[model samples]
Target: MSKLTIKTLAKELGLSIATVSKALKDSHEISTETKKKVLAMAEQLNYVPNPYASSLRKQKSKTIAVILPEVADNFFSLAINGIQAVAVQKNYHVLIYLSHESFEIEKAVVNHCYSGRVDGVLISISSETTNAEHIQKLQSENIPVVFFDREFESLEAPKVITNDYESGYLSAKLLLEKGCKHPVFLSTSLSLSICSKRAAGFAAALSDTGLQTNNYQYVVDCTGTQEMIFDQVKDLLQKHKEIDGIVASVERLAMQIYMVSLSGHINIPKDLKVVAFSTLETAPILNPSLTTITQPAFEIGKSAAEVLFTMIEKKKHSIMADTTVILPSTLIERDSTAV
Candidate 1:
């Protein structure tokens, strides 16, 4: 059988195409009686409105674009779930894109938003995003955007962030209190704002403790790779054989640190202490419960969406504000960093 279209539904109900469209959306402009009739006929005719047709005329897809560095990580998976929950509640659609931590990919994704396929955007900058021109451009076009987690300092937009700096400080201080003299910081991005803030917090803590703020003390400009990180950890271990502690910036990197310790026969909290910034549900079940500065990831997503919806409303001339929101991160003390 041939598929049903808006015209078929409109003709059957003796209504205009616009009336049928408005009824389907349950727009206040469409009367309740009309809505009931249109809905009944639509169901009977199996009429499926072309989203693209509506998108073109209304300039609204009712969709939000979510751009992330990667979704393989549990934090983002949870964040997406949170964002999805709000989107569904607000009757908005979600289109996800992964930059894989590539700034160029992030820029391209932002550029694509000019197509008006989404009402607004939520982004976590990639590790390599040094400039915010592309993001600023989107803002200029009146496409209100919100940043969650990895945010840009240049853009004056609502940012939903964790307490990365304080969390880093807390994690590092915990390791030091546990008697780890040479606590190397493992991180993914030196260019990204979140990692930089975290590293700064750690360095501040180290300096305050009278630890040599010397060359070997602060290692920056590291490569991003499991193999590279493993080799770097090995080299750091070899240099400071007495190196007894580590503060990993990302969750996945912490796993690698754990693996390296195993291969080298280093015991946690005995020969070594480890801490990480993570939101993984599996953190507690690791070989040893991992001490971590856990981000309220779902809350971050929820807050980001809440802010984005507000911006979207502003764009639509609805009542709302274009304010920035930042969420706090929680530090969970686990056996891995216990003294």
Candidate 2:
């Protein structure tokens, strides 16, 4: 049998191609009776609408892109699930791109999105991304962009983020209240806005206690290979025997601390206490349950996706460009930070 097409459907229905097309789309122009007839015939004939052709006609790809630094983080994994939930409900396709924490690679991926392959973009930028020119170029092309988690403050794009600063402050206060005299902040990226905000809040919390934040050696940058980070953590623990508490800015740093403590025979919550920003499912199952500042990662992604679709459907860039949605993170206490 010959391949079925809209032309065939129209011929079989004794109707014009335009009429058949509108009926297939359930356009209001087509009466109920006609739409029923077209739909019945389409089912009988096993006729499937070509999404690509339909998208071309409507000038919409019916697709969105999600770009992230890496998917290895449980946080990003949960965010992808949230984003996918919205995409499925909207009957839109999702394309994910990973930049592996490279600014140049992220820029290259953004450049590729300019080819009209996607209707809009949702991005959590790389740690090394200090420039926003590539994102601005997308805006200049009239493509809507939504930022989530990691974002540049200078960008005039919608942002869905957690309260990093507040969470940081709370983490420090929790440690201080637990009788920690020397608490240090461990972060992978000192330049990233989220890390800076978190570190600043941590410092502020210590400063409020009359501890000289400047002389306390409060922030430690752990950006490097896994081995290098482990070595750094080990050295920090050895050199600062007074460091009784730690605020890890990421889950990896927290895990490294655990490993270092084990090797050094340092007892958790006795010799040291630790709290971290984490979405790890294994946190509770660890040797000592880890205390965590858990961000609403899934909600951030869902909100970002919803905002991107709204921009695409309504073309309300002016209203959404300056929009910022701040969600709250939760502090979950566990044995790791126990007094």
Candidate 3:
């Protein structure tokens, strides 16, 4: 079969090449009815637009960048799938950049987006990210940005996030209901908005239970190398033998707790109940079947992408006026947190 082109679409529809071209670009000059006909024929013929020509004419890269802290987490992997689903439908390409949980790396990645390489950006801020200057700079360059998961609360960009505070309260409440006397919250960064919210909720739960948060609930930083984190967990368990339950801010910390418990011969639920914010598919298969506060990762990704494309297509200066969408995280009970 001959390569499909706008000329072929024009010839088949008995329309002028100029009309077909304008319709393909969704130009206002083309009537809605005519645009539909052109689009339908294009779809029927499996026509693929020459992105290079389109970009030259429209000054768009026909691509978007997704900057993430890391892909090691199941949540990020699922989110990527959701982002890609929308990108494919819009005939846009996705460029994924990982910051590896480093502030410098994230800043560098954000800086690279200023080169007009991507039409828009979707980002989940790094745990170490404290400054919004890089993001502000990206916006200054007219690149629309949508945030998902981790985000700087100060930024005016649209954010798609889960209800971290509520989820934290629920997780801590679950442990307390299980008769936990000493519970701890583990987080990588206290500076992160999500972590702070979750930590606050965890503390609130303790306060409501007639327990002094200072005595019963403490937030432990688990940021470092795998070995360092493992050691931290081990030390935490060893130093505080009274620790009856743990609420991990992220999945990695939860896994580390499990490892520490296994090596230390401290049984889950029996000795130390564990819960975490996770989207792990293997949650059900873990030895104790991990309990989790499962975030709507995929939905968050899809929503962020949709909002970003809306900004890109409409040529909006900022989505600051757009309301932030906060989805709830579900608390799933399992053997790990079983009474």
Which candidate ranks first by TM-score, i.e. highest? Answer: 1
Candidate 1 regions exceeding 4 Å error are 1-4, 8-41, 220-223, 316-322
Q: Counting only residues 3 or more apart in sequence or on different chains, how many pairs clash (N, Cα, C under 3 Å) in candidate 2?
A: 0
Predicted candidate 1 versus true structure: per-residue lDDT over 1-339, tens digit per residue: 346788778888888988988899899999999999888877777776677776888898899999998988888999999899999999999999999888889888888888678889999988888889998888778787889998887667778988888887888888888887788787687887888889989988998898875757654344566788788776777677767788888887888778888888878868888888898888899988898888999999998998898778766522233455667888888999877
Question: What TM-score would each prediction reach against the true structure?
Answer: 0.88, 0.87, 0.84
In model 2, residue pairs whose N, Cα or C atoms come closer than 3 Å (at least 3 residues apart or on different chains), thus clashing, are none
Each model's C-alpha lDDT?
0.83, 0.91, 0.90
Q: What is the C-alpha lDDT profile of model 2 across 1-339, one tens digit per residue?
A: 338899999999899999999998889999999999999999999998776676677778878999999988999999999999999999999999999999999999999888467899999999998889999999888899999999888889999999999998999999999999999999889778899999999988998877766666789899776778889999999998999999999988888899999999999979999999999999999879999999998999999999999999899787998889999999999999998
Error of 1 at 9 (Å): 4.2
lDDT of 3 at 234: 98
* Tens-digit lDDT string for candidate 3 (1-339): 348888988999999999999998889998999999999999999999886666677688989999999899999999999999999999999999999999999999898887557999999999888889999888888899898999889888899999999898998899999999889999889999999999999989988998766654488888887788899999989988999999999988888898898899999989999998999999999999999999999999998999888888889755454659898889999999988
Rank ordering of all candidates by lDDT, starting from the highest = 2, 3, 1
Winner on TM-score (1 vs 2): 1
